[model samples]
Target chain A: MSDKLPRLEPAGLDGWIVRLFNDIDEANLSWLAALANRCRTAFGDALVDIVPSYTTLLITFDPLSLSPAEARDRLMVLLDDLEPDTSGVAGGQVHELPTWYDPSVGPDLERVAGQTGLTIEEVIQVHSGKSYRVFALGFAPGFAFMGLTDPGLDCPRLDTPRQRVPVGSVAIAARQTAAYPAATPGGWNLLGRTCARLFDRQREDLSLLKVGDEVRFVPVSREEFERQGGDITPLEERP
Target chain B: MTDTAIGVRVLRAGPLALLQDAGRFGVRHLGVTQGGPADLYSWAWANALAGNRWGAASLEVTVGGLELVAEKDLAFAIAGADLGATLDQRPVPLWERVVWKEGQVLRFASPVSGLRAYLSVRGGFAAEPVMGSVACVMREQLGGFDGLGSKLQTGDQLTVHPAGPSNNTATQQAPSGVRPDFSLEPVLSLLPGAQIAEFSGQSLYDAFNARWKVDERADRMGVRLTGPRLDCRVRSLISEGINLGSVQVPPDGQPIALLNDRQTIGGYPRLGALTPLSASRLAQCKPGQEVRLKATGSGAALQEYRAFRARIEDWV
Candidate 1:
């Protein structure tokens, strides 16, 4: 059964792909968390980066220091040392993010309600009810792909992507949810707004959400949102 | 100017200009793309000509139109594509070091040859490092002269302190052999990846045999090639870390060659990855320019890479 725990394959010159699972689920993420930890501990400086996504961990290394063959052998050895449960690495730091869930802030919130056949308040309640694990972070800096959102809130993306999605805009697409760390062209379904400064270059810890970190979204009032540097005005107020 | 004036000041900022070094490493896990010189070969040469070591930060000017005023007398080198560069309205030769007197103007006009030109100063450009690198990724807003990952704007001041005579490398000219002519079509080397077997046999054949035209919709993130639609049975998989030259195939079937400022992770199936040196060659390609891919074994690619590194060492 352990032999079927995915395999480490070579990726071009300076990277290795650790194919952990075929599907996205909690167990796969737990295994990924442990495997990523083991890779970091074993490879140390030789490892350039470990990109953890839904079911794969791509380990980029400095070829000048570590060869793919050696990296594969070491990783296999480390995998052997891990326990069967792999639950030791399951827990991660939980971060609570403050979000403004006004229909004005999230223009698509009403539309999502219409699609999911749930009340606006219920949508917000179910959305913020559970802790979401970050499956991956990409498309933009400090942008974490957190999921599997309440299946009830499942919604399709916009037919045509918006020219620009507001920064810190909390959005849901398919089963995953995220906040746009920076204003960029996005196609995700907008549901709310967050005042959390997801990324700050000045800080030693630049990104607010890491790959394995658990995230919880807490709703805030408009006054509280304004106080926390949210400068959004509703579309209806515009001329 | 202040009493201790250092480096050059932006006289005119062109379409796009950014400070780049080797790249930001060991941080992709945090969702940061590696920001570095798009044309690594040219960047290395510019640094070499400026008497700076490899991995030194240099100014990468895209589509030209950049002008700079030397605040202090310094030795600077221009390399990569010839962007109709001029010194005080006189033609300035590229791929060589030139002594820049105080207040002398160096201007780069529209591209006469290449899409990007590299300007390297002795002792490297002085920029505060973000996440251990001065490479500027505008999307990420990290690493640059301002440490905010901004492209060069007019009136932006860049700090540079030239090395003393003792530390300066005595070469003023880039060796003729390594200089690449950006005007010609490039045949890139592809290191076949795990997904290579997953693609259709005809698609694989077409990938190599067909000439992929560079689509206008290209940037630091990736270059979308308009050629054969590489059909693959596997559509999307679990997103994974993409490297500097990962050639990913989107649902549209067009291959987008990921570049220096590409996202940290991608879910699209990939045909393979371009060799590092091949990626540098592809960076010079302008919109509408055509390029082809040739499969290469890992051993052979490593040999070429090692040889290139050895050559750079010998140049120093």
Candidate 2:
């Protein structure tokens, strides 16, 4: 890591954006997560929220309590004594999630296979072969946007968005893949369904995936999926 | 049970009625949008007149179709748009606290002036909190009267736990000078944002100089403004969490002023953001109404907000 200082810019009147790096990468993500931790520790109950994205950390505060300049000055002071963020030191919880990749469950599996000129089994092997890192969570609750998928499996979003994508849908868009926390209108290319429920408000920790965690998708059989209480994947294929 | 549960019973429910507090905060990482009252100015005033501190939950009535039959004698106040409200068949003026007796009917007909009206009880509407906010977000299916994001329905009762002593009358009313007139053109105060420099000079000039009309395509999510094309250098930016009153300009040049119920993260480049108070006024504007954007400093905006907050509560 270099000794470069993060540049602070005004996001709005009451908020400020800390630009840690110019692009999204593993190092920048680690740095952003570190800065985010510092801000969280510093702001405590005074801040409204601090949102971390690819290369920027936006800090929004209550106008009545703290002014933007005041928040900025505090961050600047923290920056002076900050240490280089070692990416995997803080968070590296690896999540092994199971996915049912049957044709019925993953409608686009065949299409993705045809596009890559690889067999369905080959695509599954490449996808679950290595652990993918969790870059960020946005769009929906527990919707972790992970990156650097196998180049062969990289694909663009559907030309038109699907009005309704089912819950627990494991899908890919560009080099990124995510599991839909809830059913919503999405444009991602669907590949499979997962038994893992990403979000449950009743739980103490509402989201299973957090920023800086690692994820791996394990392909499971229809019988195994059904045995795990997944109703979407039927035992027998429809004739 | 009846002795402990003193609440007002519902007679009629307007087009859309919901209970809202300040807003949900510190939860955007979960992709939870901040849910709160669309018209904040009115919501705050209503709370103040009722003698409750700020951030209290209040009823937000849109386009005025709500009616309430008081089951318990209560002190309440109404603010925001003149929605043709009446108490027991007599016209009840807005921006003032009115005493209510048991069995008195509080009915709202239609919009005489504004799109939404705020009504606050002496205490505040009682609702189970979800994710730390009682503000209702129907899209998320969380936080409301039943702890689920359901709009106010006919026969739904509103429970209020008194914050102060149950008084027969509230002597305070919004001063005449402080009351906003919804009929005039809205001059929204904009604090130019990060994307302000990316916009073409001509586009920036037109954004402030030209009069823009509020399009019919408006909701708690955002209000679309129809005006001259606002050309920007960048096609899109990385998606970031949006705050209340963030104004994003799309490729079409028209700007959408995002409100309280907006998505947690968005990719569109924002020309700037409206002050919280300006957003409150914009919420009251009807479709096709003309509005102009004015640039203001962030410090001035903070000061203005502090002054407004001081008016309702005992703040030094």
Candidate 3:
């Protein structure tokens, strides 16, 4: 069992990269999360940063203060003491995002349906059915890559990605789905559009969701979206 | 406390300017970046000249074109780059301390020496710290004079504590000549990693022997180098955490040297990493500059690094 656990390798100059050999499954993610939380809670001062990804955690430290060998030894001790939490994330808030599946807003709905060999209605039904677990927030600020979608609707990414995907664009790639927090270039297939602002710079909390949060998209009518003060296009469209 | 102190009013803020201390560490899990002066050497010298303690917060000015007016009579030191700084219609010497009278204007033109400059006051700038640091990271929106990660702008009032007792002028002299001859090819030292065998022989030769050009698409996060394609036998691997100075070779075959603002994790295959000092030297290299990687033992690298740190400690 110990041999099956992830291994650590030298990263850049002053850090180490932990690699989990197993696939990105629930058990692996939970273990990774537990180890990360414990290590940070225990040695918060000595460690610079602990970045947890899909299957690994990167631990960085200041070489001037702490040597690489010392940091690795400490990490090894933490890993040995870590016990995988069985409760499956003690607390996670649920967020219901209102999404519109209109063709005009969802530019890649037909594309996703064509690739999945399912009707447009069937595509939307399968998408809105299951609740998604927020695996991580990365690539861009507030970009939440949720996971474990229904296998039936899973499809590959677009061959040539759109130069600029609109913000609030609900996208699907493989078994994962995400809401574009900000208008940026993306390759994911768009399935729907959302009026909810996933990221608000002015707001105290900035991000609508964080890692380990649960997300469920609720289908809404175009009128309801507009009534909710949804902009006709992104705020940056005029600019 | 002496009431006479030099204050500068922002006239034109360039791309980015922030109050930086050593950096806020031990907080990556909370999603905070370690923000510090881009050029640590110059920032240290500025503080040394002002007779301030190490880890003192100072202003890091990038790309020049920052204008400020002296609000009160104060002594300050400008170190690191020339930046074509002028005071009251007279050309001021770079990397030296000077007294500015109230209402005197200090202007910085385009970069004449280096990309970034450090300006230090006698007693470090008085700013409230966030999370045990005063360094500003815009992405995290944490740490700065206002603790909001907002860059200095026009009409913004900057407050500084009264200057303290000054020591005999700073002994460290700024290097003469233009910009440390960055045009010459840069030799970056790399310590091999665990996956050295994963790369092919040809790839290894090309990586160490070939000269790579700095790509224009470079930022604080990482600098991409364009050079001969290096092939790695290890095609797919588990995503792993990344570190500063990690040289990752993507599918495009170009090497990207991760820096201070890099992501916490990455998935690409890594050749190794540049030393911290090497990374700092590479940071000074402008785009289109040629760089070559030289593999060195970790023992030697660590010794050289400790010597460098000891020199900085002596000044303090």
Candidate 4:
């Protein structure tokens, strides 16, 4: 177990990046999550934030309370005795996001179809065909980075990111997919829009999707989208 | 608990004014970034000068043009960046506690020296906390005076918690030695990050010695530094959690130093990270201001930070 422990890289004066793996896989994410839990139990109030990304666990601690050497030593000890529980990750909850895939909301639907040499209908079918695992969440609140899209739907980011990718705009960059929890500048290829509130402060879990969850984009009608609380305000691409 | 709190009306909201505390902690896993005062030094000093405790909400006034009129007498302190503040047309001193009588106006003009100023009332401003914090993050639309992360606007009413009877004492002032002289270009201290060695030898040298100018592309999220193009072998990596002050160099070669409101993670190759105090110093710099970075070790950086925190912790 000690030999299998991930490498520790210095982030700064107060942070350490626990590199578990180099790729985004379910096993790596589960191990990172397990390590994150161990760190919290080990450090207690001394820890500031333990951010578990696809392949790394960035642990930040209170510099005042824990010195650099002390933090390293504790992490080493914790990792030596660690046993990752992959049970929860394998059986994680699946969330169905009702999506309205159309040119009205998904402006890049035609461009993506043209680039992929596939019909627009086929493109939508391919995207909605398989479920993606929620690898990580960042860039904005409740923005889940779901990944491993079908090879047929693989697309590059926009040459120039939009000034404002409207809220609920489901977009894809490379092999990853996510919905804009809020209106923000983004460079991902717009595929569709969803009405599900990805984030709400009033909810116990602020983010709708957590790491290790599965998400499927369920195609729906424009009227159904509106009925499900989707906003249909026309969006324009601005430089 | 229901006692009437003092009200402060915004006569002029200025460029950007938001309420901030230490910041929202223990919630980064939710993809939420910490939205604290860009200049922690000034915010802490202002709170200390007003005899307020740590985590007390303070107003961060940027590129000041804020004007306020209190409905009742209030005790407050202003610190960081000589913003040319005035009370009822009379000059208000910086780094010192002062009083604004009922109906008297307090105005902050454009920066005469610093880019941001902190205004902390004796009892701190009162607001409903969103996600256990009042630190306004406009990007996230969370945590502010209205608990909706809205910046101060003209005619907005701000509530201030009343100071206890114990706090009614003589005016306090921050020592002159402790105040930063924002006129001089800062030499920020950097701790070489994990990818420091990945850069070419020349790029590494230029990173430390080059005079980087503060680019106009700056905000609470991050500040871009324009200088020599720092070429790195690695174009990108697995996106990892980005800490405050992480100086990541994109393909364009310019380094963007992540700040308080930066995204939770990034994949660009990082040259290094600025110390927290250095980040606070850089936050006060105006656009096009020349600055340099000096490499430092974690031990020395921690020592300096601990000393600064100790000094503030000693304050009431």
Candidate 5:
């Protein structure tokens, strides 16, 4: 059955090809993750980096060390012997990030509430209600793309992106929620602010979360946020 | 052990001077960009001249104007660009070995030949490795002389491994060739990507025929080329992992040649990717330089790359 998985033509860039799965869902994500873990464990040094996205995983390797054809054959063998483990979910740390939902902290909270036709408090409630899964850490360093936000709170990104989004900012767009790891230009709809540093250069592990980590946001009062030393402002201001 | 300690004091820092080794590998999953010398050819040559192995940490001086005073006698070599260098106020040749005595000043004025220059000592620079590399990534703030990704500043001290047995004679044949004329028009070789057929016929014609101008909005991440707007039928698609030199054409039609500092993944529709050697050439090009893209198959591209690598192996 694994051998039957669709394999696309090689991308013109040397030693890379596209492997597409029919569908992407929670069940498939687990299968993909388990398969990736098994391949990494089995042929540890053969692979360079295996990045799992929302619907796909890109396994990049050293062309000089291992040819793409050989890598593809190895992947097929690992997938054939792999058993999907659905029970590996729900074991990540529950990080209670101190968020200040004030208008100053969240520049787009009012706009988001207006767009969704819900009160600001209702928007906050819908946002903090459920635990979101960390689909991947990409788009930028320490930027975690957590997902499956409440369908009611889904909002499209601003047509004109904010020139700069502050670090530790909690934002939502469509079905995804993310914490801005650093001050970078972003288009996501800002909902609140968090003091918990999502990325720190001083730490051994720079990113606070990984691809398979689980995340839950806990809203906090302005006083509590201040007490937690959350006064770090964006290095650059948004236009 | 006492004889190996060589020191240099920074008198002036160029636009950006950072200690770089080969690069940090096996950590992209952690969202770290491989921050090494923007020009690998020059970096490798500098190390080879110093009789050090590949991946040794060397000084990556960009847009020149860097000056250093030797605190002790040291043997060093300068490779890469002709960054008007002067040893004790006398013109010192580029891409050759040179000896400096204690208290001698080594100065690199504004770039006369190329954008970046590499200076390597007999012994590699003494810097603590961060994440198994001394390559500096300012954006990520990891890996440098201090392991903090900080650029060299005036008054900063650089420590090098103690001077080894002075092999003042050239051990390897000099790379003989005229410096690439950056002022001349550049022809970039590109390999057509998966979505080549997705582009409009007129766009494809223009892509191959038209001369594009390198836009000023260029950096380590990418260089945006301004030319005929290429219209693609595919407006949007799933974002996937992007490789080095991926030529992504957005809605605006201008093609962006992604480089080392590019994002890990992107969704933009791409025409194709420039070959590795072509990318190295493109890195040195200044803004407003005319560039024409030549379409070549992957097989030919790989063969050219192999030939270059083979030459490198001969030197090793």
Candidate 6:
């Protein structure tokens, strides 16, 4: 019943926060995806941008063209008739990332294994064992926040974020998992590395992953990882 | 390559200098930030005095130490922070157009008044666009002189796009009223946001009445304000899209004003957001500079924004 309802709150001068649900989960994301699509179609050029996250969508509009009152009225109309896609097929795209769960690149592999009381091989199996849904993208360009990792692989973020997380490092924070699109300071638990270029300006599509997409990490050989352009340099040794 | 022959060459790249345009839009869903000039008012004035339209690429020089040599005869203008700029050992005036003869040295020393200055040539700087904008975002590694989101470097040859027919806007001076006095402590206008009710009355009173100092950990990304630790009932929320001037409050109660290069979304609870011009004014403040925030309504804020836009659109 909560998934069917939505509330709109004003943000600043020209922003509107469409609070769909209070919690983060697969249902919230699906509802947000449906709402995002509708907002784009309904608002058109008047909408500057619609930022979709786990449970809310922040809609910014062009104040010159559309007044807040008018935008609010239109948004209410859309909300009144909003129908979230109950069908499972609305989960958007699915992509598989070939991952290397090795200690050479993933320096935290042993730490995570030790914490979870699982062997290195069992950690890898638990991590690459299931599909994860992308809850949102933030923190950096092309960074996908995928989530709901198995309970065994759950881990807390570092007390202090690393000075530099190697590009393409596959990491997990709590139940969420992501790969560093570009080398940046990060705090997630490093589980492995990926060859996939998550964000590339050279490519036709800038970001490889999008909100609402499903991602599955598949374990790959070290040789295959290097062949696919994955960085094999040890994390600690990298500058 | 040949077209860039008539341009400015970086002789000495300062601590931070980057190319910025209006900003990237319609790409926040990909987690990309809107990278643009931190001080829009100054950047616009510089571009206008150079006879370029809005959204033209200009150089944003922070804390000043940048040195450049003109490759050929060029018309340029400098605005925003004075930065004690000198041309060939003579003082280069601010808020007005000036000529740069071939091989003449142009340099910016330490800040005399403001923290950042805008440098604009007649034709505007040219850089390959990334994600529909030439605004350099070093964090995202997109849009700069190299189109790879790099800051200005020594030996970098900044290419200037060819100017259109000389117009009235060129050789014009910025109105004195529009040029901000960067030396003075600024009172910023804020439009209170959704979570304003969650904060205690005392915190809200302190947020407005207290003099907040800018923290040393400030950059293009955001500026953290050190003041009364704001006590709020809600500590966090589902991450939402952050605007140019979102004033987010972390658990520590210190508020951070998100700026041009901030992350697209944040989970910290926000008290409100600063108006655009107020945010621009806040950007010019040095670390430890005192500032005050005044709550204002959306109607008044929009009116002020439109007036500024109209002034730029229709120059006297």
Kindly indicate the candidate among 3 and 4 with the higher DockQ. 4
TM-score of chain A of 6: 0.93
Q: Any runs in candidate 6 off by more than 4 Å, and if so which?
A: A1-5, A85-91, A237-239, B1-5, B169-171
Per-residue lDDT over B1-316 for candidate 5, one digit per residue giving the tens place of the 0 to 100 score:
2343548899998688889897776666556776777777777777777766678789988778899999888767777677788999999876666777889999988777666788887687888788778888777777877777799989989888764564435454357752356556778888787677889999999999999999999987889999999999876555566667788999999999987777776778888888877877787777777889999876677677766656565564
Q: Candidate 4: lDDT of A141?
A: 89
TM-score of each: 0.94, 0.93, 0.83, 0.96, 0.89, 0.96
What DockQ does candidate 6 score?
A: 0.59
List the lowest-lDDT window of 10 residues for candidate 4 chain B: B162-171
lDDT (Cα, tens digit) per residue for candidate 1, span B40-71: 88999898878888899999999998999998
Q: Which tens-of-lDDT digit does each residue in B1-316 have in candidate 2? A: 1223456888888689988999888788777778899998889888888777888889999999899988888878899888899999999977777888989999999999989999998778887788888999887777888877899999898888755664424357777777888988889999888778889999999999999999999999899999899999876877666777889998888999999888877778888789999999999988999999999888999899888877766520
Per-residue lDDT of candidate 4, residues B141-179 (tens digit) = 899988888999999988888787645256488876889
lDDT, candidates in the order shown: 0.85, 0.82, 0.73, 0.89, 0.75, 0.88
B-chain TM-score, every candidate?
0.96, 0.95, 0.88, 0.97, 0.91, 0.97
Worst 10 contiguous positions by lDDT, candidate 4 chain A: A1-10
lDDT of 3 at B108: 78
Positional deviation of B279 in candidate 4, in angstroms? Answer: 0.5
What is each candidate's DockQ, to 2 decimals?
A: 0.59, 0.48, 0.33, 0.61, 0.39, 0.59
lDDT of 6 at A22: 80
- Native-referenced TM-scores of chain A, all candidate models: 0.90, 0.90, 0.88, 0.94, 0.88, 0.93
Off by over 4 Å in 2: A1-5, A87-90, A233-239, B1-6, B166-170
Q: Which sequence of candidate numbers ranks them by lDDT, best first?
A: 4, 6, 1, 2, 5, 3
- Model 2 gets an lDDT of 0.82
Q: Candidate 1's residue-wise lDDT over A54-149, tens digit each?
A: 888888887767666777788888777664235543456689989999877798889899999999999999999999988898888889999999
Instruction: Report the TM-score of candidate 4, chain B only.
Output: 0.97
Give the candidate order by descending TM-score: 4, 6, 1, 2, 5, 3
lDDT of 3 by residue, B1-316 (tens): 2442336677777776778888776545434456677666678778776667788888887767788887777667777666788887798775656777878887878776556678886677767777778887676566777777777787666767775565555463433431244445779999777677788899999999999999997866788999999888766555555666878888788899987666555578888888877876677666777889999876677777776667556655
Share of reference contacts found in each model: 0.68, 0.51, 0.49, 0.75, 0.35, 0.68
Tens digit per residue, CA lDDT, model 3, A10-98: 76556776766457664565676777777667666666777766777787766776677777787787777667754546565689999
lDDT of 6: 0.88
